[model samples]
Target: MSKIVILGAGHAGGSAAGFLKQYGFEGEIVLAGAEQIPPYQRPPLSKAWLKGETNENALQLRSSEFYAENNIDLRLGIAATAIDRTAKMVAFDDGTVEPYDYLVIATGSRARKLPLPGGDDDLLLELRTIPDAERLKQALGGGKRLAVIGGGYVGLEAAASARALGAEAVVIERMDRVLQRVASSTLSEFFTRRHTREGVIIRTGAEVVAVSGHSVTFADGEVLEAHAVLVGIGATANDELALQCGLECAEGIVVDLDARTSDTAIFAIGDVTRRPLPHYDVMHRLESVPNALEQAKRVACAITGRPAPQDEVPWFWSDQYDCKLQIAGLPFGASAQVVRGDSDTGSFAVFHLKDDRIVCVEAVNAAHSFMFGKQAIAKSSRVDAATLADESIPIKETLL
Candidate 1:
């Protein structure tokens, strides 16, 4: 029987293994992971998991028996050290070698840490793994303070969670506004207002020069002391194994729509791949659960000789303090934005239009707008901006 080896058994890799079986591949599936535990959800680590609203049992993607019953050889607590593309073998940290008819890379990304002068690396925490979340949770509550070094989604989510646990939270951002890289200015302002209303201090345009123990020093000579510090600047793709094997890579492992890397026998997915957008001409590395699940289906179809799944409009969601933010598609080259509903009411949708067509939608507690906007973007339907912006008009009627 042909054997398929999947490395980095996270969401993408784990799901791919299950999908191959679901698609009737009739092949040997070997899923290897660096973590000792079964594949679990990472998104909740900064939200529900951190706030003690969820447990480990809820985080697992699949039960242990599912892999055993499915005949998948799930190897955990081992890291792939090198890949021998010529021999079609992979060497693991445990001194084991695995040969495969096909290989899937889903190494994912790692949290980016700032190199400070104080050499206090141990004092800083990150929320990429279960252990990291556990550590941070243990350090929170009882009026403890958390100093977040970045104002991205992860940072903001953790701040909200910290506040939920009765801990003070302060977010320090280097950019001019929070979520500057990913969100529009209006959304950023909305979140800033909400977080502030909830007693979270947000420091934008602040540069951190050093971190000493529990003290974070700013370039402008401001010092903030906290019980714990979290570094959530961004993530770097874990494409080192692909690079060592001489695969084509730019910012991440370069792959086509089918998730096939430069090497025909090797495929990459999830945060490790720089994949092409469905309708857009550009390629992007999207780090979202939706992207991982979509690419997992793509890899399974590619390996099993099945028809490729329909291209989907990329979407993501975040839950912070009773507000649910749903974003769909990229706002690339958008010339105008239309706001539906009212921001002050804690419910609204920002539609980004490119050439009079809906390109992206950022919806806050507006499920109807998000769903409609997502479908419109997928269909590439043009919209009447005035109709879309008018709260009196039904969302479905706004489409041209």
Candidate 2:
């Protein structure tokens, strides 16, 4: 029987293992993870789970019984020490070695820390793992003061959750606007106003110079006090494993459409992989669950001698203070943008167009628009900007 060993055991690793069995691969499958817990969802770590609306049980992707019943050797709380490509073996930290015909790397990513002075203070926390969420959750309660560093999705979501818990949340962003790297100015302004209304103080263009305990000093000589500091800058891909094994790696492990790394024996998935976009020729390292699941399915099919699944149009969603924000496609080269609804009412969708074709959609509290926009972008459908911008017309009708 062929032996397939998967590292990470996060969403991508776990899904690949389950799908391998479903595809009738009677191979010996081993899933190893650094976390003590079973494969669970990470999206809720900053939102629902942090708010105490759900427990660890709800976070699990598969039950402990499922792994046993499926004949999967699930190893938890164990880290893969190194990969020996020549020997086709993986060395574990516990001095155990696992030989495999195929190896999949789904190591995911770690939360990036701030580089400013005193950024490593104990009170400065990052939310990437369950333990990180637990620590942040404890601080969220009792109406404590929260100073969030960074204006990305993680930081914004943390601020929203803190405010929901009756905490005084102050978001300090160095950029001129929050989400400046990923979102448009209009969308950023909308979220800023929304957060402001929720009693969350948003300070854009404010650079942090130092962090000491619960105090954050800005470059502009402004100091902010908080019970705890949450750093949600971004994440760094876990690509050291690939680099150590002589795989071509940039910001992430470079993978082809087949999810194969430079070493064909090894494949990569999840946030750790830098893959080519479906339509665009450029490589993108997506951190969303949809991207992870899609790559997992694709890798499974390829391993089972089946046709690889078609590359999907990447989509992601976030919930903050009763607002559901759904984004579709990558808008890196967007030339035009159309607003479909009122931003003041906190319900709108920003349609990004390139060469008269829909490329991306940023929908806030607009599900129907997001669904249609996602499909339209996937199909490379072209629509008139006037029609797309018209709220009077249904998004479904706007599809070309």
Top-scoring candidate (TM-score)? 1
Model 1 per-residue lDDT tens digits across residues 320-393: 98899999999999999999999989999999999889999999999999999999999999999999999999
Error of 2 at 149 (Å): 0.2
TM-score between model 2 and native: 0.97
Instruction: Give one digit per residue, the lDDT tens place, for model 2 in 220-245.
Output: 79788889998888899999988998
lDDT, model 2: 0.89
TM-score of every prediction relative to native: 0.98, 0.97
Q: Where in model 1 is the C-alpha error above 4 Å?
A: none
Model 1 TM-score, 2 decimals: 0.98
Q: Model 1 Cα displacement at 390 (Å)?
A: 0.4
